[model samples]
Target: MHLPGYPFESRWFTHDALRLHYLDEGDGAPVLMLHGNPSWSYLWRRLVLALRGEHRCIAPDHLGMGLSDKPAAGRHPFTLAARVDDLDALTGHLITERAAPENGWTLVMHDWGGPIGMAWAARHPGRVSRLVVLNTAAFPDPHGPRVRPALRLPLWLLRETRLGERLFLRHHAFARLATLPPFGLRDRLPPDVRAAFLAPDDGREHRLAVQRFVHDIPLGPGDPSWPLLVRAGETVAAFADRPVLIGWGLRDPVFDPLMLREWRRRLPHAQVHAFPGAGHYVLEDAHDSLVPAITAFLRR
Candidate 1:
């Protein structure tokens, strides 16, 4: 992906027959940046560039996202548990390649990434040195981490009404809306920046991850990903003692103050910074402040 300010080499981690895309830049302490749905490793491009000089920045685009191979519905599990497993397998391969730094890894997560990264950390608790959370959630908040009312019906329609393929696959509604104003971002996207975000999601099949990510949100115990989500919640709750930093965008419609409060309840000792004007794309809107804060946090 040759874009402005993201001059990094592409690396691949093989899983079965598919090629998972990742970025390995610079050296020293390893920082694994995991992105959520509708976004890719491209979401962490700024953070990677900022810290690549002093840190080994490894950012992977999850299967069906970014440059990774997007297998058809039945071929890929497309569940939360599978996403976590994919991340673990990719990192394990990296470890074998001597890509891991001497120090334990640092995890930076956003959106769906909170669950994936934390689940991996749960698998190897001692290996994660620190955690830096953006606007994201590890567990479902049963009571009130409520998505905005305006978005509730449309999301329900997308999930239950079988309307996902039409909107996501055909019109690219979710993908297009994510980078623009009042949808996922607080700032207006420049043409090039918006284009970069939309590049991987070109054809109908390419939008599967975006569609499945929404459909996979486990609402109850009967859901396919419920067991793993429970474990992720339990594991994430136990990390209060680990050094943690949170930079939240107060304007996020889905992950609002309630989500932040939930995170605080789980990790009471975490250092948190809330950006009132920033939206779901906190990394993009609050980059100036968040990037430096993350840089300093990692150094410490």
Candidate 2:
């Protein structure tokens, strides 16, 4: 779909027999931006526009999300490991296999990107020069005091029950709700922006990834993605000395202040800027302030 103000050239690479889409803009040191579930590379449009003039901004749509080809669950597992491996393959196709710079790519991530990008960074810690962590997590911390019971009950319903499928797949409630009050832009999100985010998952087949993502949250040791996430979380601390920036929205109910505190604890040297009123999609609410701050951070 033509994202109204986002007009970057689209690039595609084949992985697991499906066409994965990404944005490879400009020419210089790479700035790899990874997005979370339900959101795609489009989440980084403003950041990409800000940095593409001086850096190689690479943002990929995780298999089932964004403009990428969405295959059946049988064809693509939609697990965290699968998502991370897709990133590994994309890196090989874009940077590693192509004789790109040895290291110095800035890893920019949000939401599920936390685990996916951190998994990649864990595999090749020496290659990443910096990290720009938005409201995301590489590890599952159940002990956080802010883990609200109010949000947990419904999330469990979404993950374990068929009601979620009816709500998300049949009614497209997740997409509709994401664009509303707490999850997305604080103000009424532009109609075009909402359409662009919702367009890719309009069909039942297209919505499979969204449903699977909701189901993939690794809550415990038995979960399939648990080990990988644990490893990724451990790996997050390896880059403590590297330049890091944490931009967060204090109002995010899922990844709340506790997550930010964990990040600060893990990366004590990292710079953090938290917005009190911004929701999960903090960039939409604080882009004017954040983009410039992030831009300066990148340039420095």
TM-score per candidate: 0.95, 0.96
What does candidate 2 score on TM? 0.96
lDDT leader: 1
Model 2's alpha-carbon lDDT is 0.87
In candidate 1, what are the lDDT values of residues 1-300, reduced to their tens digit? 446666778898889788899999988888999999899988988999899999899999999999999999898989898898899888888887765843489999999999888888889888888999999988876454465576689878888775766998898898898888787889997788888888988899899999999999876677787778778889986678889999999999888898899999889999998999999999999999999999998888
- Candidate 1 TM-score to native: 0.95
Pairs of residues at least 3 apart in sequence or in different chains that clash in candidate 2: none
What lDDT score belongs to each candidate, Candidate 1 first? Answer: 0.87, 0.87
Write the residue-wise lDDT of candidate 2 on 33-71 in tens digits: 998877888889999999989999999999988899988
Cα displacement (angstroms), candidate 2, residue 201, comes to: 1.1
Candidate 1: list runs displaced more than 4 Å: 101-103, 142-151
